[model samples]
Target: MKTSFSSEFAKRYGLYALVTGASEGIGRCFAEELAKAGVNVVLVARREDLLHTLATHLEGTYGVLCPVIGADLASPEQVEDVFQITDQIDVGLIVCNAGFGTAGNFLDGDIDTELNMLSLNCVAVTRMVHHFGLKFKHKGRGGVVLLSSIVATQGVARSAHYAATKAYIQSLGEGLQQEWHGSGVDLLIVAPGPVETGFAKRSNIQLGKSESPDVIARQSLKALGRQKVIRPGVLAKVLSLALSTAPRWLRIKIMSSIMGSMTKQLPQ
Candidate 1:
């Protein structure tokens, strides 16, 4: 959002940044923000028509090239194909933000749905990072960001799978940062408490603690050069710290209660 960062990010990217899940929500914000910053973006999502429409709008308004890459991230072959497409682009940045969550117990939901969530949230992220990260490192310049959740800090009840998947992001990000030390590869993991992106509505979560997805995207971009866990608010930071140091039982109990209440909207 800052003029300096935008200029620099655009310069580094040289008209190429990949934003997954660009159909809507936080992913859409990432694409728009990147375009505003003067970086050409390749939007990836399952919806081809949405991507095409967005591409036209972005190109017409920002004068930045907006390419659409349609693929189901839950599929490894599709994920590989995306990498091949991006392999030649001067992609100095990547926002691997394509992910979804369910609002019910493990067994209460369809088994295939849970597996799809895992593949998209965890496996695709790791694989794409592996693909782009290696290339970025070889080029000696690039930044990668992973979208995580505040719930990752503790065990929550209804969001059993979602919480764990986000936890994996937190751990993976921290670990990769260490492994890539002095490698000129930047990795940032963002954990936001809640966003007003209507993910809650989609999951039937009624809580109003949601922040705007645009705000989250801005904060995430601002935290790019910094190496640390980025949270959007003081409450998010406090919760993360508390969950990290608090007694296991207490943390679990609190998260369980909150998530349990939230999941009341789901099937019984």
Candidate 2:
């Protein structure tokens, strides 16, 4: 008999999953999906109220145990505390999905904000992967989902720092997937395009067409173990392919045009 993806995930990765940035967007969807598959989850985010609300909903709807942890991933002390808080919970799967973006000209953008973005998107992610990866390696079973973005393939003009950080994640995930192969652990990097989330508003960018977060989350889970890297939607896949196949000069010009439009939407 063939096993379902959700059940296979639960079985191979164990019964508990920890999701960062679990208060909203794709992170929240991941928690709900895992709960539906009978996996207890530890929800980590900066907004305690939102996390608790989500925990309550998941517990009530799916009958799964959901623990909430409020932590700012950008802060070293808080990121360290996340592991300490979850020390007792046997987290078999980790979705290091906590990250943010910024838009506008690199020179015009606040330097501090960009650095903080790097800390959360790169440094914090590195720490989380290293800490949990060792545990998964020792056990010889578990999985990790690292979030990247379609913009990772090139230098996006207005969102330079954000794109760079995602590029770092993409490379990291690719290398880790190879390193963990045949070791009974799995790593998947999901590079999604624009989604209907708070990201656009926060980044002050005008996003074009976008898909629902639910679609991205579901596709991401199914792609796990099956693919090393995935661009969630058809549009994103097409864009990724085009970027890869296009000449460097053409790609840069195209992305620059897109970024110019997005930047125009930013408040003066």
Candidate 3:
């Protein structure tokens, strides 16, 4: 490698990044995109084999070292383990994107399942920001991105719990961004309407004309180093703004109708 400023800085700093849920979706995109930018990536996911494959692909294709950590972020112990691995590295970027959702009535998923989603979406995001925010403060520079949702702007009846969790992420991102400004840490709240990833299959969601993970990931990185919340697609942005002015009952009805169509596509 030529000893350019980038290569020199990367070598001296050992450019590091931590991306949760890296086996798929936005987090996977985050890992690949960062590696493509010459950042050594540490990908965390529950599926060891899948993450290992992703890690190898990034290293082989991007020529950036990618390591995998098998972790269920919903567990405090696992979250701690993730932090321990980063203790010695100067992680300049942290992408908290580990989350899952269940549609239909709030009762569609069991309470235990709901808790898992809550833990992963809201609690885990806060924990990652807390740890990395402090580290960033001490290190003097860093960026954080949290995956929120366009549904977070309103109370989507069919995805009650799911919307609430994303809302928490959105709220946290806004507050942290404001509070951390000039403090050397940038916070990005990503509200992607519908991403074309296995998330639809895993979460049993059906979204037509969804954005790709790469599209969202690129938009997210652009938003970083700047103070702005992000939404993946123009259509999603328009929908979120239109819904903001819509009557509560009407919006719920509209969301419920859309969700109803989605549910019809899923297995019974």
Candidate 4:
């Protein structure tokens, strides 16, 4: 994978890649993988300390530049700041991996937290994609990887808003994939199931099984220019296959049940 990435991926996407939420988890793995493949990375996340640490490590290990950008994407102003900074760099790949999920009953969810999640997961992503998508199209060569989730396939009960946000990304990426078919730009949507990230704890959901973050990152990168959508990892593939042929209502029911179990321990 590293050898292929060093040649094919680097040539296709260019020398520099920008990854959001790059302080940890799948985003961090993506940054590491890209750097290892000889691509410079721009790391964006709210944690400046972590970003700096990771940046230093990647730079030292891979001998590639790692620029750290600390800003909360949930804020529209901050998103602009990120754009302005990144605009100065020659980033050929944009990975929108900075998103969070909310679990538990919709009625019991905090309105502010829900809105913030919307801002970060949807509005921020839309703004980033809109800005970079046009830039990439004009450049005639680039890649865009949008992080979605398996729950995006249906209306997850305990995670309704989170699922909706990912659904938006799924639709957007799918549409752009078609629109950019002959435009020299590749758009890939990564809809993975549970992953062993901070997401489960942060979202207040528990999962019995999950894939490693490296699995998600590697698979997504491998599928970037080759496919429009990929449900990475064995668990994600299995879940997608099982639900793909089900009726919409049944899919929803199954997803709802799964989410309910995950969030059942949370406060009502």
Q: Which of the numbered candidates is closest to the native, going by highest lDDT?
A: 4
What candidate 4 gets wrong by more than 4 Å, as runs, is 1-4
Error of 2 at 182 (Å): 0.8
Clashing residue pairs found in predicted model 3: none
Model 3: per-residue lDDT, tens digit, 1-268? Answer: 3225345435433488889999988888888777777788899999999999998888888787787899999998899999998888778788898899888677656899889999999888788889988888887777788888887766776678888998888888888878988886777888888888888887777777788889898888767765478777776777777787888788878876777787775443
Q: Highest TM-score among the candidates is held by which one?
A: 4
Q: What lDDT is reached at residue 163 by model 4?
A: 99
lDDT of 2: 0.87
CA lDDT of 197 in candidate 3?
Answer: 84
Superposed Cα deviation of residue 245, candidate 1 (Å)? 4.7
The C-alpha lDDT values of all candidates are 0.84, 0.87, 0.81, 0.91
Best first by TM-score, ranked: 4, 2, 1, 3
Candidate number with the higher lDDT (2 or 4)? 4
Please tell me which model should have the higher lDDT, number 2 or number 3: 2
lDDT of 3: 0.81
The true-structure Cα RMSD of candidate 1 reads 2.0
How well is each residue in 180-235 modelled by candidate 4, as lDDT tens digits?
Answer: 88998999999999999999999999998999999999988888888889999999
- 17-109: candidate 1 lDDT, tens digit per residue: 899999989999989888877788999999989999989988888888888999999999999999888877888889999988877777788
